[model samples]
Target: MQTNQTYDLLTQVQRIASGDESAFASLFYQFGPRLHSYLTGITKSETAEEELVQNTFIRLAASFPVDRNSKSFRLDLPGGQQ
Candidate 1:
């Protein structure tokens, strides 16, 4: 079951890397609620959670050609810092 879910997520990430808007939307809908809940718990602020979620997706979309080979998630930080 975990393997299947991982494969499916990889597929979605690949599609997203190819600039498929709907794939990105699908991922957003799939994880949005859970991400919101987690963020809310960590930040204890609905507004912050919402903003963080939005920023996260924006970063994901902006980081194209998602590296499937890399085990660690990487988002290019501000000021060109990795």
Candidate 2:
């Protein structure tokens, strides 16, 4: 079950790399709230959480390649990528 979940996540990421807006939006919708909550907990500021979440996604998008060769990849965001 866990492995299947991981595979699904990778597929979503691949869709993102392929310039799928819906896929990116899905990722945002799926992860954004959790990320915001976690960030707010750590920073104790709503504004900071918002900024961190944006920065994290920006960094992830910037760092990832369109033609990634690896089947599995990990991105190390500052507060993590949700």
lDDT, each prediction: 0.73, 0.72
Candidate 1 residue-wise lDDT, 15-61, digit = tens: 77765667777888888788988987799988888788878877777
Candidate 1: 10-residue stretch with minimal lDDT: 73-82
Give lDDT tens digits, candidate 2, residues 4-31.
9889989998887866656666787788
- What C-alpha root-mean-square deviation, in Å, does candidate 1 show against the real structure? 7.8
Stretches off by above 4 angstroms in model 1 are 66-82
How many residue pairs clash in all the candidates, one count each?
0, 0
Q: Against the true structure, candidate 2 has what lDDT?
A: 0.72
The residue-level lDDT of candidate 2 at 40 comes to 77
Deviation of model 2 at 30, angstroms? 0.9
lDDT over C-alpha atoms for residue 72 of model 2: 43
